[model samples]
Structure formats: C-alpha cells, structure tokens
Target: MNSAVSFFYFLSFLTILSAVMVVVSRNPIHSVLYLILTFFTLSGHYILLNAQFLAAVNIIVYAGAIMVLFLFVIMFLNMKQDQEESKTNLTKIAATIVGGTVFVILFGAYRKTAIEPFNPQTYDSQIGMIESLGHMLFRDYLLPFELASILLLVAMVGAVLLGKREIGERHF
Candidate 1:
C-alpha cells in the first residue's frame, strides 16, 4: 500500500493496542501511560486527516495538561494494587449480553447512514486552521464550548475531592 495508508494503519494499530492495554493493565500508572499513548496515536490520526488544530489541541490538552493532572491525582492518592476479585459466571454472562446488545445497536445505527466520498480539491482547508477554529468556537459554538469547560472543571473538582485524604486515615 501507499505510505500514507501504511502510516494510517500503523497509527490505528498503536491506538487500538494502547486502548486495550489501558483497560487490561493491572497497575494504574501503567494504564495511565497507555492512555497517553492512545491519545498520541489519536492526535496522529487527526494530523493525517488534515485537522491540524484538532491534533494540536489533542496533544496539548489531553497529553500535556489532562494527563499531568491525572498523574498528579494518581500520585497524590497513593493508590495501591487492587485486590483480586472474581466475577460470578452469571455476572459475566450478563455483562457480555449487555455489551453485545449495545454493539449491535450501534452497528445498526451507523449502517443506516451513508458515508460521503472524500474530495480533497473541494475541501476547505482553512476550516481546520486555528483562527477559523477559534472563531467558530467563540462565535457559533460559544455555549457548548463554555459548557464543556464547566464540565471539565467539575470533573477536576471531583478528582480533587476523591484524592483528598480523610482525617485520621493511615497512610500505609
């Protein structure tokens, strides 16, 4: 295949592998690292799609800032390896059924929609520029943008609360 296609596949593989690792890793620190790798791979995909602004934000916001905060919270909490727990067979079966149902529903929903062919010549390259993205975010999507920021703030506050130690608790 062409170089671009090959690179896309490589990024996709890395993204999927890291995402799975994030889910399966026993150590929280290792999971967070894998999650960062997944974010980097996603940013690479955005670059390949020619959404430079998105790629930059993905790296700066997710990999740079959010991950730092996540790591800080993890360290501050002084988390330990979780105790092993086994799920009953019925619980596992129920989870699998629920997951399969959700997957089938999502697949059917997307299958009904038609994908448009890509046309590079007619694409508005300026649309993905920082200036244009800023204008759209501030002018057209101001409410949604502000809402997202508020949501992020609430999440951070929640994280801090969760990480805060209770009085008289042993550090161990």
Candidate 2:
C-alpha cells in the first residue's frame, strides 16, 4: 500500500511489541524502558492522527517525566523480596477474567458508537493548537482545570508523605 499506511502499521507493531515486552520483561528497569518505547510509538500514532500537540505532550509527559519517575521508583524500591512471591493460579484467573470483561465492555461500547463524518465547513484547524487549548482551559473549562490542579497537588503531597519512611511501616 501507501508509505503512510505502511508507517502507521510499523508504528502500531512497535507499540504493541514494546507494550507486551513491558509486561513480560523480568527486570523492572527493562520493563520501564519498554514502556517508554511504547509511549514513543503511541506518540507516533498521535502524529499520524495530526494531533501534534497530543504527540508532543505524550512524548514529553509520558515518555519523558512519567517514565523517569517510574524508573526512579523501581530503582529505589529494590524489590527483591517481593519478586520471590509468584502469582497464585486464582489471582491469574481473576486477573484474566477482569481483563476480559473490561475488554468486552469497551469493545461493545465502541461498536455501538456513532461516528460523525468530518465536516470541513464547520471544522476549525486551530482546534488542537496551544492557543486554542489555553483559551479552552482558561475560559470554558476553568473550574474543572483548577479542580484537577488541586487534586494533583493533593496527590503530590500524598506521594511525598508515602515516600518518607514511617515507624513500624515497611517502605512507607
């Protein structure tokens, strides 16, 4: 087929492979690295969708900062004792059932979704631009935006509290 379609498939393959590797890798550091690769490939898909802002944010926020934080936690935890415990068969079966149920629910929901065709006349090319995003966040969605920020602040404080060790607590 076309080069763009080929590139899209290649990126999709990369994303899936890295995602699977993230789950399958024995080493936490390697898993984090694979997760980073998955995020990068997802960013490629965003670029293919012409969502440049989303692509950049995915790369910068997910692949960059979040992955670094994950790697740091993985390294700092030194979870050798935890690794000795293998998953029970019941736990694995439960996880599989839950995962399958969620997948079926999402698939059925999306299958019934009515996708509207693209309309050039009503479309705004600048909809995904940073300026438009700023206006939308500050004007139309100000309250939700501020609330999310406050929630993030609370979560950050909680993370800091959990990071420090407490008396009679293991890795708390």
Candidate 3:
C-alpha cells in the first residue's frame, strides 16, 4: 500500500476512535475535547485527499473557533464529574440486541454497495489552495456565504442574550 493509503487508514482510525470517545466519555468537557481531536483528525484526512482549503477551514472553524466556544461554555458552567451507573441485566440485554441489529443492518448495506477503488490519476492537477477556494466561494457560493455570516451573527446575538442576567423588568 502507498503512504497516502496508509495515512488515510491511520486518520480514519484516529477519527473513529476519538468520535467514540466523545460519545462515551462521562464528563461533558472531556467529550468536547475528544470531539475537537476528532475534528483535527478529520482535517488531516481532508488534507490527505488534496482538499487543502477544506482542511484549513475545518481546522479554523471546528478545531479553533467552535471548540473555543465549547470550552468556554463548559468552563462557565463549572460541570461536575459524572458518576458511573450500573446497567440492569434486562437493560443490558435489550441494548445488546439493539446494537447487534444495527450492526447487522449496516454490515448488510456495506456488502450490498458497490464501492469503486480510489484512482489518484483522477485527481485534478490544479491545486486547491486558498486563492482557488476563495475564487470559487465568491463566484459560485457568494449568497450562501453571506447567509452563513448572517446566521452566525444571529447565533452570537442569541448566545449573548441567553447568557445575560436580567436585573429588573424594563419600564417604557
């Protein structure tokens, strides 16, 4: 196998492991931290796929900005450590049955799908640098881009409003 394929497999493993950790971790803060690690590993996979611009954006938007917000919220909340609870025998049996059913469904779907192997030669020779991405974003996706900015602005305002403490009722 080529280095690219090996690197892809490594990144896939890292991303999946971290994602599982994010879901299974008891502490909310630890889950968020593991989710950040998963995002970073996904960015590495994007880079390996020659989508450099997407990788950079993923790092900046997910690993850098969003994770900072998540950490800030976690710290502000001052969350306590979670206690482990033992599952009942009946509950464990039901969970195992459900999990096995889902796994079998997914395995059957995978087997039914026709997956073509990757061909490196099919990759476009043009570089997906920031400049090229910017050009495409401006030319093709300008409206959606501006809408996303507006959506983010609204979310920021909502977060501030929700976090603000009300002292007294306002009089006209």
Number of the top lDDT candidate: 1
Where is model 2 more than 4 Å wrong at Cα? Answer: 77-84, 120-122, 160-172
Off by over 4 Å in 3: 76-78, 81-122, 156-172
lDDT of 1 by residue, 22-110 (tens): 98898878899999999999999988877898998899999999999999898787766654345568888999999899999999999
Error of 2 at 51 (Å): 2.4
Which candidate should be chosen as best, given TM-score against the real structure? Answer: 2
How many residue pairs clash (N, CA or C atoms closer than 3 angstroms) in each of the candidate models, in the order given?
0, 0, 0
Model 3: per-residue lDDT, tens digit, 12-119? 999999999997998889999999999999989878867888898899998899999999998898766654345678888999999899999999999999987867
Cα lDDT computed for each candidate against the true fold: 0.91, 0.89, 0.88
Pairs in steric clash, model 2: none
lDDT of 2 at 87: 81
Q: Select the stronger candidate by TM-score from 1 and 3.
A: 1
User: How many clashing residue pairs, candidate 1?
Assistant: 0
2-62 per-residue lDDT for model 2 (tens digits): 9989999999999999999998887888999999999889988987877788889999899
RMSD (Cα, Å) for all candidates, in order, is 4.5, 3.9, 4.9
- Quick one: ranking by lDDT, best first? 1, 2, 3
